[model samples]
Target: MNDKVKALLSILESAGFSHDDLAGTVAELNDAVNDGKSTSIQLVSPGAAARYIKRINDENVFTARFRHSDEPDLLNNESNDERIENPNQDSCIVVSYDPAKQ
Candidate 1:
């Protein structure tokens, strides 16, 4: 695996995702590459991503924000102020990857 994939897997693993839970995500990423398109991996939940951000000691490898699924364009800043000020179950975290970037 490339360094980016390795890093992402490490983050997910640290976030408490089991290997079984990551199988589908791995498959999806492979499929996206085969099809020549960019892709994003949706974590198990917003809470899981939040846990990773809060618990992991690494310099931020991923950006987390609060975005309501229905709004799509409405995302809080990278600082996550909105998420902290107002938690919403309707919001979901979208983790997008740029494979071309090292």
Candidate 2:
């Protein structure tokens, strides 16, 4: 997996998203990014991601839910597969990797 996949998986894990849901969400996000529909994504805290998702809707960037609570006595809270696009956020911050340094 590439950095994007790793980051997406990490974000989804932290947010409590299920493996099944994560599969679709990651695919969608990766598609958007690769197609130039959206910029790169940064893994953030769940709360922060939620807030940011709400703030950005329609235009550029978007977010996919990746976590849910595990409930034994009640139904689990499903991760929302919502995408938020922010026009203002139109840049991808990436750094060149040096394998020799590793």
lDDT of 1 by residue, 50-85 (tens): 656543334433334444544433223334333333
Error of 2 at 4 (Å): 2.3
Model 1 residue 57 lDDT? 30
Give lDDT tens digits, candidate 2, residues 1-102: 445555645644654545664575466556655554543333223343443333232211343332222211111222354322442222211211222322
Model 2: worst 10 consecutive residues (lDDT sum): 69-78
lDDT of each: 0.53, 0.39
With a 3 Å backbone cut-off (N, CA, C), the pairs that clash in candidate 2 are: 15-67, 16-67, 16-68, 17-66, 17-67, 62-84
Candidate maximizing lDDT: 1
TM-score on alpha carbons, each prediction:
0.51, 0.35
- Which candidate's TM-score is highest? 1
